[model samples]
Target: MSTLSYETELDKLLKGSNISHDLPVSQLVERALERKEGILTSTGALRATTGKYTGRSPQDKYIVEETSIKEKINWGSVNQPISKEVFENLYKKVLAYLETKDEVFVSKNFAGADIGYRLPIRVVNEYAWHNLFARQLFIRPNAEELLTHEAEFTVISAPGFKADPNLDGTKSETFIIVSFEKRTVLIGGTEYAGEIKKSIFSIMNYILPERNVLSMHCSANVGDEGDVALFFGLSGTGKTTLSADPSRHLIGDDEHGWSHTGVFNIEGGCYAKCINLTEEKEPEIFNAIRFGSVLENVMLDENRTPDYNDTTLTENTRAAYPIELIPNCVIPSVAGHPNTIIFLTADAFGVLPPISKLTKEQAMYHFLSGYTSKLAGTERGVTSPEATFSTCFGAPFLPLPAYRYAEMLGEKINQHDVQVFLVNTGWSGGQYGVGKRMNLTYTRAMVQAALLGELHSVETVVDSIFGLHIPTRCPGVPDEVLQPKETWEDKEAYDNKAKELASKFQENFMKFDKVSDIIRNAGPKF
Candidate 1:
């Protein structure tokens, strides 16, 4: 195994005062490891695991391939045999960090078919949690489900890194790995075995995509011809709710990977907002989790399992189950090139054009803008209605430097000739600040029109604000509903709200003012 240096940049940050609290790493790693072993020895683990978890290095271990992309990204092939050398390298990096944190405990269990180790609750600074752990270890609940039946699913490996403080006041960095089969998650060389799985999963979602996938914030899925469309925005921006249509076979909801052929889901399951979710509201997804669903971090009953009806855990309560659990799940983890790319934004300010066909630059512009209303309680810190701009509707986990993926999108759009559309999945007659949300039924109908290619037939008029062609009216939906009205319950209040939202959009567009004429003309769109 390569000798890993104990000092990582993250370690330095952990020791800084900016951190509110510190959990002992050395102590936690020990406990977490023990828990893992206990779980592995249990009947559940035995039934689930098929092959040996450890083995000698595979013959193809030493060969390294090259990519033109600037970063030295690792591309683990689906066909290549996993190597022990790689595992050792992971172990070494994890061990070095654990030792530095002084919170890790080592174990060698020879009694089982394979040897194992563990870690307990350990403190990891937020920076390390967000950048390193989130980036290196975060696994999508859905992706995990997709790999569940596969041999790679057994270990549930989690690699986390932390830093110690330096002279410049930054932390030294180190990495740690905790395997779930062993029931542990390590931080700063320490192990934590408590209710850390959910926390670990949450942090992981925050980072892992930056590695190799072409991740977008938009809702992406494979269409009939294998084309993928990505819908993006904050929670309640219609990512799960809108994409739940039965007409198109559902790929995974939310996050997706842009593979060479096309896009594939990174998750085996969907993490949807359950606030207003119901059989009538989201019938397709609501029925998907009846038997196989695993509700995470939820309020449990006497048996220590989740209470599906319990709202005590907060509205963010989530459920994870394999996509196959859904009545119709398209698998093989691949989707064809996107035929149409629809970026969904819930425009609270009803003044902006309802729908617009985007040119290439406009697509990137809106993606970077990442327009979505900050619904009151979806996130922890966001309390009010704030406009968020995430590149490609997914700013958080983008792996390649932003533009690289944009370039890839450009390449794909050019090659496959995919069409892009921006739809407001929010209110129309009023602004988010003052008006009511757009009716779900109407939004769904609009989406149906766009997907079926019927919206293109509407009379085209150059929108005054953005200059993009706005369909005068969708066939099934009313025209008056397309634009915000001034004569609602409070006309003056509606006008004020509209102005505020329009200004916000313009302000958000200022940074990208330098984009080329075609692209620029394509945006600053209302």
Candidate 2:
């Protein structure tokens, strides 16, 4: 209602609480407004409180920092005509933001001839950083020229994006900057500044002169006997919690890339689920948030902290906190190739409880399945057991071709000889509303077995309905819970529920039937 600068609005946003308790808004604002004069001649050149390297190799000296408009502020309320010229005319502002800084790293990318900015840590917010590494903003770049350009990092902005293809065809409101050396990124959209945190860990790890690593989408950490189990799943699966095991040493969670040498984390922070989360249920994750955590758009309490009990705002709650909060967070987020790669599913029918040992065909089947329930308030309102397809794990946010990455994965599994398993983190024995969620503790134990290489040896029965191989005994889980059962308060109700879920899976998979016969058979066998 009153005239206010973008700084003023940023002040309010900074002071506001995210789902995570503390977000250094003032610190972020101050840095965002800093000067950008000096040139960075060093190998790597970005410096936040923790500082980072932006070079591909030891000798490379990329642009340290750049500038842009602070678009998150609501200019209409302030009577400022919405500025769409930001993408083209924000160099002065970028310099002003860089004026206060000593050394920083920035990257730029060109797709064909389309140029994009990879803003320094200052201009990009924590939330934006999250989506960047999630590969949500992967653009089709001019690979030939990109290789020629000295500045391999650049940021971009695409406004008014609605994740729909038909109605809002070619319409999206997303801005992101990607890094080549660190292979990290920062992403944001109009409604939200940054929805997910990616590239923070691997970027930080890249700077450190320790383990040579690269960021990935698979979750891996040190487990029993120093064996690390890598958990790979589509969204809504329990990759974060299952990998955040207190009993094991956590390397990193979510988004890992592997090579002949080692594995690395692509995120600077952790983007964790906050819907109905409690300290008692996930102490490792609960404790990870404190000083460096940035809570994203969650309803706060009088104390300006997350009210986990309160669900009035939005259930798509998320927290962005530094990985250092995890007990044994390793810098340069790298580890030996995963001993096990587990595919996770949140089967709403409650019929799939923690299955394991997916054959290569089954792996490709579920890989293309990309199943997960949509958030209640987000896009299409809460619907019944929705089956979405993402090429590898994420289809919306990737820079490289989906099949290229998938081929890489298939090769890695063969080369490194990594074992793969499938686990459902959602409801079991009953549907979502009707059945209780399987204990996170049980899921953790089953994952531990997979990582420890115990589940790989003893698997036998083929599940009648899903056609998945069921392991007889998964160290921590009882034998009976291996297969999903149609158990409901009413027998007819169970039949109807299973039928409904089956139908949904069938329809979603029908389109991909040409991809493979296994995936063609992904629908409920009955």
Candidate 3:
């Protein structure tokens, strides 16, 4: 029989609750079905709904201000500050609430694939399904490693426990508080499984940079010749889908750290957006959705088969599966330095070219701008395609200042002589409503050309307003499509929209201080 030694320590924290430690997948699945927390789809995958919060509650997230790392944090609207007293008080309440629960599921895992930098973490979930999520998302340890493991950071999640805004100093009843001093994260009032994954990512974002490691919110893949390429973009920009290329070995679908040695994946799994998923488009991700995968807020048909097209539940429908499930995954999830970096944007305005090479300064400018269009229904309250700027392509999960990550990225690009490209995965002819979405085949061909360095020898034209070098020709792409303005019937309309987006870029750049003149001048000049 396996020992329950780990539970003894957790039992003291979650007093009075029936502690279920390191339960196997079968047992956890049984417990989840027994409690009706989730159901098994015909494919044997577990389907669960995260009531009230189908997505991350970014507004409710907090970082406790303490003496140890008060100034280190970029405290503002994004990284909200909570007094140490508030964290302590709420911490006690969360534990007390967990104690009252009938059962608690515990998962002990590691966060980084690189053992040297990996953080040992323990996650305590109120629902068995959540434990299953931790199992699929985090790096699992063997029996011997589990016996001797000690968590560097711990996450206590009880979605059933809602905070009192007036008393707990939170924006709402939902809260996700990270205490650096206590080395713990307390999550309540939100059952979004993403919270569990992102909490660890936030911690790593803070911890990794301090160690001179550049933590990135991007997807990575390695070519046959060991060439590494990074895809940086926000949620809807196809980072996950594009990086799962059959021609390359996927390092990871999301979250990576670039150190002096190489790039390492911060996660052991891929949490892919499942809405509109089709087997013909993404055969690998589609095929990986069988047993052991956890589907969140996904709608199902009468036969209990998942309806990837259905958004009745949520547009943020996701599927979490281990990286090994991907046919072309790197086992250790580590690779040498990246040779090329692609910044992806879903440009709803369609004024941006389908693909453009970026100068060093321009790369830094776009990295800080991190512009992407959020399609309607991707998140609650988003009714249309809205242009959004998230620094480093993932501002919400970043705990440090935006410039720190940008600086690290710039340094890496210079040191390694990396080629950078800006690829628009958004619109082409006019705007979101008027222009058609960029054909996936064309996008793939452009990406392939960029990766293969075929565009280096191609003739280029400078975008007058945006100051971007647009390639006049690519191997498989039409010459007319290379120039976005030429593709539009009304050239004047394209000019107007391009200038408008340029103004928005300038306006957003004003928020950052102490940026170099080179980066400052790299924006659209209209």
Which one wins on TM-score? 3
lDDT of 1: 0.47
The Cα RMSD of model 1 versus the native structure comes to 12.7
lDDT of 1 by residue, 246-345 (tens): 7767776665656455666554456555555567767886666443333333444465433446655444555444456555556544566677888777
Best by lDDT: 3
Which residue window of length 10 is worst by lDDT in model 1? 109-118
lDDT of 3 by residue, 159-197 (tens): 998889888888889989998877889899988898898
Q: What TM value does model 3 have?
A: 0.96
Instruction: Assess candidate 2 and give its TM-score to the true structure.
Output: 0.64
Whichever of 1 and 3 has more lDDT, that candidate is: 3
lDDT (CA) per prediction: 0.47, 0.48, 0.89
Model 3 regions more than 4 Å off: 1-11, 14-17, 377-380
C-alpha RMSD for every candidate: 12.7, 13.0, 3.4
RMSD to native, candidate 3: 3.4
Q: Candidate 2 residues 303-420, lDDT tens each?
A: 4556656645455455556566678766545556666677777776676647667766666666656665543432223334455555455543343333445555666776777777
Off by over 4 Å in 2: 1-26, 29-151, 156-216, 224-226, 377-385, 399-401, 475-480, 489-526
